[model samples]
Target: MTTAPTPSRADALIREHRENMTISSWASDAVDELGRLQAAERTLQRLGYQDRGGQEWAPPIGQAPDFDLIDSLRSRIAELEASKNARIHKLEMQALDLASENSILKRQEQAELEVRKPLPLPLPLSDDDRLRLRSDVARAIWDVMREHEDRCGHALEDVEPKHQVWDCADAAIRAMKDKP
Candidate 1:
């Protein structure tokens, strides 16, 4: 029996796998960004800046600034800034990985295309020849069906078989013939 050449199938599988990996990578990045944003907000809160109108100012100018409060706020801000930098680093790493993966996929596809050149078609068969071929296939299928029935000790009576399979096969053959 004829089969789809191995390299074409392999390339298709590889492309699908790469696509899934890319989606997963992008989801991971989104989660990482969300976590980073949350952490930044928490850090800001820890720094003692109440959410008053749009501005953040230390206690009124004349009300003696508390040294302890100032120090705590400064520390929190520093921690938040460090966390932000780390998040940025993670994003950069993800970008690099995506770029490398894209390059590899492109190269693999190009190689596959080069390896599988197309072939010329065979001459068309006469209607009689086609009918004979179909009959042969049907007989072979009947043999397999009989074997299956014997092996399972079950009649095919309960099966809800339909002509859909034949229709699909006809469509596929037509499609193949139409290909250049």
Candidate 2:
């Protein structure tokens, strides 16, 4: 005997609404399709698809593009810059102290001093270099969303729940940021 057919996205949503339940969470296909829709909206938004026609649409916690990667890289870059600035500040303070002594030898020493930070073996790549290496990987995530949009529809006006889409996407991003 043949098993019952899997529920379609439309059918699952309709049934859930009619039955006052949430089959979208339980049904695998429905969940996957919803994810795809959300991803498409996110991708389009990232690509800067604004609705001049006053249309609204967006994605939930869909595909993770370069956002996480770029954010992490930026955070690391900021930390490094702060640390480097602190080191520079120390050097400046030392220089100021030496200048106050009015000693020729101290002046000469300060001029000759070199702040050489330790370079690890195979020295770690500069932030720009590291970002360059990882950026392509992050950008590739958009293709997955694009594929979904092709199957569904790219424009937000074409999709349902247009107004709620952006809110969902914001919530998803907030949730991601909240996580360690």
Candidate 3:
């Protein structure tokens, strides 16, 4: 006898399972698309694009050269150059002033030297004159030493005796005359 074909539940179950899987996959894709759209909206808001009425914001990436940094650097360099030039000008003015003062001092020194010419030495002198000159020399030396001590706070020992002796004697003679 011919057997009737077995009724199979497997085909119906597989069709239902496939339909549910398809529906679940479509739902997942929709959620992912919604999430991407929300993320894009947030990014646009942060970039102030939303303030422009939800318009798409497309900034040029690596399409144009940025000169903002270059401009800042140029500004800084200009400021430094200006400052350096100003300082150089000030130093130059000071140097000129110093030069003028130095010349003035030199002229004054020369004039004073000319005015205070030393006494001419004689061919021969008496013993009394020699002794008087020696005493004068000693007094001059002591005066120079005193002046140096007052001006620089230096002791007589700090100066060479030979070098200071004449200066001291001259100073002493001048002091004596001033004591009118």
Candidate 4:
């Protein structure tokens, strides 16, 4: 008087039961994970972690106040950098000044060398002309010596011969140049 279900129907029912058990197992795992996550969130909140403006959870500040030290160190580093830059600028200026001084010294040395350089004579004189010039210079010197002796009432030969020759030669050359 009882009816037996077909084998296909039994297989389908078994499959449906297995599916339900899998879903239940998954739901249990999800619940456990949810509880663990909630506990972790509570612990984080107690440790100063917070959700600022309903956004993502922000990191907690540590137990110690190290931010102040970090800020001071950053400012100190900035000051040191500024000091280094100023020193570099000063060194650069000193180098420029030294370069300028070196350039001026080089120019002065060149000018000194120029002054010491010998000048070329415009025209070459023959031997006869040289002899005549010497004679004229001697005559001029004798005249100057006589004039000095007459004016000072002393012999010009009292001066050293070397000294007398230079002074007399200069005057004689000037006199010759002045002649037309």
The residue pairs found clashing in candidate 1 are none
1 versus 3: better TM-score goes to: 3
**Per-residue error (Å), model 4, residue 169:** 12
The TM-scores of all predictions, comma-separated, are 0.32, 0.27, 0.34, 0.38
TM-score of 2: 0.27
lDDT by candidate, in order shown: 0.67, 0.59, 0.71, 0.73
Q: Write the per-residue lDDT of candidate 4 for residues 1-180, one digit (tens) a residue.
A: 978879999999999999999999999999999999889888767667886655578887657346679799999999999999999999999999999999999999999899644333224667776556655565556666777666355444464556665566656555545555
How many clashes show up per model?
0, 0, 5, 0
| Tens digit of per-residue lDDT, candidate 2, span 1-180 | 966656786688777687655454468778788899879777777855654444564333545467789899999999999999999999999989887876877766766573222222223657775454334323333334556556344544353544444445445434544555
Q: Which stretches of candidate 1 lie over 4 Å from their true place?
A: 1-62, 117-180
Model 1 / residue 17 / CA error / Å: 99
All candidates in order of lDDT, best leading: 4, 3, 1, 2
- What would the per-residue lDDT of candidate 1 be over residues 78-174, giving only the tens digit for each residue? 9999999999999999999999999999999999897543333355878886666544444444456667666355333332345333344355445
Off by over 4 Å in 2: 1-39, 47-65, 103-180
Q: Best candidate per lDDT, number?
A: 4
TM-score of 1: 0.32
**Model 3 C-alpha lDDT per residue in residues 1-180, reported as the tens digit of each score:** 976544576677778899999999999999999999889888755554434455656554443444687789999999999999999999999999999999999999999898565666553768887657756667555565577666456544465657656555656555544554
lDDT of 4: 0.73
